[model samples]
Target chain A: MTTNILLITLVVLAIIALNTQKLRRAVVYLGVFSLISSFLYLLYGAPDVAIAEAVIGTTITTVLYLVALKKYQVFTIYFCSDPNDPNRRNLTNNSPFINNLESFLIKQEMEPQIIYSEKPLKTILTQDKFDLAICQTNQKTLIYGSVDDYQLDALEDYLLTNHGDLNIHLIRYTEGDDNEA
Target chain B: MTDNSEIITRMTGLLYPFILLFGFYIIINGHASPGGGFQGGAVLAAVFITRYLVDPNRCIQLKTLKTAEKILFVCIILYPTFFLFSTSASHTELMNLIYLIAMNFLIGLKVCSGFTIIFFRFVFYEGGIL
Candidate 1:
């Protein structure tokens, strides 16, 4: 009965770890899973394997995953603009808003990678994987940010408070939403 | 300056000697026990990791450790081939026990150094200062 329970718990933990949205939480789940598996190993009379599992699986891998997650600080930004407008070419790249945003991201300890794309905003939104997308149309700058992104709330606050004169509109959208913003 | 909590540092500090003693015990009694070199080495490596949690900026001699690991690996390979396979050496109970203990010790040291190096490299170079 105990073995069956452990096996069931192990399967449940593995599924939960796989489905967890947050990387940190997934790492924690994996740690728990390893701990339980090691216990199961001990129950099966392989104390050596159990000890190895307990040591390597529970501790080492969890720390490694956490460090990797911490080191991954790069934030990707996609800039999209109208292709036909001749003025769009010069206006998009030299914007003071982007410079400020980059500086703000750096201040937040994120390495921002800004990519200038001639593709339409909708195409970039649906096709490319981006943390934040900027669309320049006429006088207003439309910033589409992921709702799941923890930094979006702070970025919105910063933009509204500091750059009120820039006519920047922040739009929060969930992933895979096809609605035009 | 290490930003580690006083409680954590103190607790792990208290636990350090016990962890070291346990790792050594595993390596020494490897022939009679379920846990041998690799598992004990991993436990020893955990000591270094806990040391990291206590003081992130503590300097560990990685170059010396790498050299030691390589030398230990060579010794691990040579020791078995010389004693176990060579017909000239007589197999006694004491010698067999010594052989097992010595091999486990060498392997434990090698594994401990290797894991520590991997972890330190990830922390210092890949994961930045923190």
Candidate 2:
């Protein structure tokens, strides 16, 4: 019965680790999984392997993963929408396009920080510090990005190729305080 | 990374001697026990890791550690070939036990240094650079 419970818990933890959206949580889940596996090794009477697993898995690997995570830079994106639109509530829920973009950023090994703001595009551009500022007006999406950002070109290419039907117009600006068409 | 936390630093400091004691115990009794060089070495590596948590910028030279590890590797290889292969010595139980204990101790030190180097490299020189 004990073996059965541990096996089931191991399977559940594996699924949870795979399904977790946050990378940090996934790392933590994997640590727990290794710890339980070490216990199982002990139950199977392989004390040497169990000791090695317990030392390497439960402590060292977790620390390494966390340290690597600490080195990953965060990419901030500000998402703005017109406050008075009749379909404003729909914008609060993530659209398929937003999800796709987030996944794309994750694939590039970046942690995306998306902030939804109801402020005007001009105000957001002048007031906030952001890597990408997206404004949704009616049926069209306007993306404002700084020219100095190296990743902007790849992001623009990605959006143009994959989401051309969304009518995204990429606008480049010199700095945050000033906007030029 | 180096934040001064009273509880973590103090508790780890308190447990330092015990951890070292356990690692040495594992290495010494490895001939008759389940754990040997690698496991005890990993436990010893934990001592360095906890030391890092207490103070990250202690400035232990990795070059010296790398050199030490290479030397230990050479000794680990040569020790067995010289003693175990010799035909003149009688294969007594005590001599065999001594041989196992010496091999385990050398291997434990080698593994400890090796793991310490890998951990330090990951901590200090990982990412951003080639």
Candidate 3:
């Protein structure tokens, strides 16, 4: 009886928290929602949904938001605000490779930065946020790099797809914001 | 150094069932409402983590684990987000629910895969004698 009431109460509170202007708070609320929703699922005899809520609803979403926050400063404003705002700038516009970074990396050509890394591994490494660590393990040439989870993920395709020479092991701990392992 | 069973063995014996229960709860409740695969998988993964912690020497090989995660993560992002915009209906309620479910599933996949990877990275990567 009380469990149901408490659950409903929590859902209401989480909804309120999510509506706030601050991005971090919203992420927090979403986390709360995930936790509570899991409990609710348990109450309603839906163990499956409860587990998903706890894991997916709570953890991953928060990590994604936090990652985005750490990288982009959380955007601070809701995405829908101010269409005519001139100050907003797109950071991804300046890229030397195909289309944008994803396509450039996807097409199996070394990035311009990769070419630049020919100087000194450390010197070229300073040019961008990502750093490569090349090695020959078991005669299978490997080029590991330092990148965020997203970029690491982008690099993942190159790995599993059997890219002939590149066995990448992204060391995610190298750069800023390293909460995740 | 400390008596091994005093801390870990007891904990594993005690904690295993609850963790399993938690995972089951997440899975069964998923489709009709909030939770789903990723969340459930994560809970299941947590059990492995718990097991690994208690006994570091044991090998936990979750085969085809990464692939499943990738598929789920991709589905979560592309499917749900796309559906959010694509499905235009008069009820608006149904659309909202669909979007929410899609998003949840994506999250579930990502969580499951991520936990699995983390297991490899931290717990099991070095192989024996932690």
Best by DockQ: 1
Name the lDDT value of residue A62 in candidate 2: 84
Model 2: how far residue A120 lies from native, Å: 20
Selected candidate, larger TM-score, 2 vs 3: 2
- Per-residue CA lDDT of candidate 2, range A132-151, in tens? 89888788899988886667
Evaluate model 2 with DockQ and give the value. Answer: 0.29
Tens-place lDDT digits, model 3, residues A37-112: 7788788888756655676667555655554453332101001112233532331234221133335443533222
lDDT of 3 at A64: 50
Stretches of model 2 off by over 4 angstroms after superposition: A74-181, B87-89
Error of 2 at B74 (Å): 1.0
Docking class of 2: acceptable
Q: Return the top candidate by TM-score.
A: 1
* lDDT of candidate 2 over B4-97, digit per residue (tens): 6889889999999999999999999888988999999999998998788788878778899899899989998898888868856688887888
Tell me how candidate 3 scores on lDDT. 0.54
Per-residue alpha-carbon lDDT of candidate 1 for residues A1-181, written as tens digits (9 for 90 to 100):
9999999999999999999777789999999999999999999999999999999998899888876776666788888877887887676666677888889998887778888898878888888878899887777879998776778889999988887886989898789332111
Between candidates 1 and 2, which one is better according to TM-score? 1
Ranking by DockQ: 1, 2, 3
